[model samples]
Target: MGASLLPFQVVDYFKPGIFPLMFLTGPLLYLYVGSLTIEDFQLKPIHLLHLIPFMLVAIHRSTIQVVPISSSPDLVENPQYLFNKVYYTLLIISAFSYWFLGLQLIIKHRKKMPLYFSNYTGKNSLNWLIFVLSLFLIVFLASFFSFFVNNILGLAPVSYTTLPLNLTVFTFIMVYFGINQSAIYSREKVHSKLRHQQLSPEESLPKSGGALLSDEQIAALSALVKNYLTDKKPYRNPDYNLQMMADDLAISRHKLSHVINSGQKKNFYKFINQFRVEEAKAMLADPSFNHYSVLGIATECGFNAKTSFNRIFKEETGLTPTEFKQTLERSTN
Candidate 1:
């Protein structure tokens, strides 16, 4: 009885231009379901929050049609009022979830790049945030807010007002798609950056020599490297070479070179590369870092070129960067 009594306009609601697009929503289910399934296998959140829109769209369309019909010929007496309430509550929950997810993604990326920030201070960051926020607002806010405002405060409801509700939903869809496109673009950028880091030699090299370090020297060198890597301030005006490193360590160049050569059993290039490679390795260990390419990792690690990174990595670790990555993945899995 309930199925028959359900407003028949459900089918008519999707007409002509809108029907095809509405039909595509089914396939979109694949994307969300597939991603969630993979996340499950990895012991990650299923992110059902993102999938709520599909359910909400169905609810919105049905409610829009049924509420009017319930007043007319097809009046099923005492039709569950709680049905719409439940659907609306779910929509609100999903909207909040998406907002938090969006903010989390932006925050994570900003921390990765010193130049990247989340606040409104910089034009770029502000613009990006605004664009993203606009997407959410258009997609999930306006229509819902309008509904509440009309019901509570005598403001006009989008569903009944001059505004076309479908148009609002379409605008939201476009904004959502834009966010997806931007995410893809950002992923590519991070990939390139990681590849560049992998090839940089200075990142891989140790301060002097040996795998082990004295507590005091380790503390100082760690601080120096951390500051250097994080701040990225200018290199000094001098040679900017081994002599500089030796001077920084407050040791003679000969002693520094000897320690690097004999103790670490590596030349300057290889030693520096060790630091770079290790750092790259740490970054790669993170699932979020998967967007970065091997080439980007090389450059970020202080390798001047792909060729050098590969050669030195193989010589020092007895495995190529790709091989190392594969090995790491396998072990972790």
Candidate 2:
């Protein structure tokens, strides 16, 4: 609809009132990233407020079509020129703002991931999102510049012809990812705090008033955490996370994070996955577990997805699961 409106004069007979759609891109982007990052995010009545700009633009365009306030003398001299200018300007602003917001959401989501899952799987990771939004930022900037050149500067509007093509490319990219990318979270998984706990500001602070613990204290905590993992094998649970570990040890989540990040010099996920990887290696080496396939061993070692299991295992051991199993068999012979 929006692409069809680019050659406005040629399509005038079609009555394509799609200028309002420009306002929709931003809000939809903001909501898409929000849904990915925020577990509890849901569409509310308040979210409708984001569409107000589109509604007003639609009304203005409809009014111009219904009432001929001035004769059509090219696009500039027409009485509806002011409305067109406002719509394009707002479209640029809206795209830039939403793209910026989406980038921030992705950054926060990346930072938050290490605290929860041991492996950043395709389903939950935002690499595709980051790529899509970065492209959106580029397209939005190009569109903004094009609008400035054509409308504000009274230029030849060469860029206007390319706008629809750029949008087509963007749409194709989005469709490809939408079809290939897995869901970030299922409905049941979204509400599951077992993986990620939404902590309050106060809850994220340490008991030591945000002061750094002594080296000895940190080392002791690290040792305690390691011993706990060895004895209890919490990583055996696919849903295990920092919050669960903290609760099991009667410590705060922040303190556990500190111990893992500062003391062990690793994020919570890597620290936990180290144990899981070791367990997988043992199971792969054991002749008794020969009945278990590579994926079966991964599942037994607390991995929910075979792809993530293979990736993380290779990352930690510099060998794929099958190759590692082959080496084990060779050594036994």
Candidate 3:
């Protein structure tokens, strides 16, 4: 999409072959996000259907003779111009549809992460990917509006074109995202085992006691989780997640999630953070750890970052880590 203006904006490198690629922007964005968020994502025959539009347009363009775009293009009389007008309109509709679906995937991903990860970093939460998707959506909207108003409806003079500007913005956004994506993903090897999420269920536990599992089973698993978390202190690992605990407990993710959500009435994230906060409070009151700063204490207490530790600490204690520490000091005085 960023390079779609090459034919019109650059006469010397004029090749509108990328014109058909507008049809692909939505699918590509949707799929790219899906791959990152969906644990079991894979290419299937049904997904190939998305490529048909691009293929048909590419094939059609091969047989047609497109007029050269000069300093000012007036291809209104050309069949290619009419065809492009129609497809670009479809592109707007198709792209928006896919963008909305892709946005939903991201939304689902955001909601799902807390169910697993204790602290959300760039790699674990895919925030950078979501940021890139937002920019792409914005740039596409601007580019479509510019093309529709200026070229299709002829509402403005040739000098009043935003296509070049939009294309340039989109290009830079893609390049920047591409460069950083590798580094972010590389920081933590995205183990597919960890992303073993069933987005369909969102892994929500049954609302009632008599919903799915037997009471005896829930009770047994609840005991197991309490013992594992308290005795072993797995929550101390900031990178801890649902799958890791599940694997350790020799249970399914669903069963472990049910034990935490249904039996204990806490989501995995809160259940774990509660432990960390308690550990922080214990350390804050202990003179043995006075040499440690608040952030240092947060690290010892299993929080990966200070900001999150501070936020969650306050959420639990009604005071920041530093404030809580000062309260302890004053109480002793």
- Number of the top candidate by TM-score? 3
Can you rank all candidates by lDDT, best first? 2, 3, 1
Local accuracy of candidate 1 as per-residue lDDT tens digits, 165-221: 433554565456445532211211121111223222333345446554444444544
Candidates' C-alpha lDDT: 0.46, 0.72, 0.71
lDDT of 1 at 3: 24
User: lDDT of candidate 1?
Assistant: 0.46
List, residue by residue over 218-257, the lDDT tens digit for candidate 3. 8866876776677777778777888778766556777778
TM-score of 2: 0.64
Worst 10 residues of 1 by lDDT: 185-194
The regions of model 3 sitting more than 4 angstroms off are 1-16, 68-80, 159-172, 175-211
Candidate 2, residue 140: Cα displacement in angstroms equals 6.5
Clashing pairs in 3: none
Off by over 4 Å in 1: 1-8, 12-81, 115-126, 138-142, 149-333
Q: What is the lDDT of residue 286 in candidate 1?
A: 71
TM-score of every prediction relative to native: 0.35, 0.64, 0.80
RMSD of each: 18.5, 6.8, 6.1
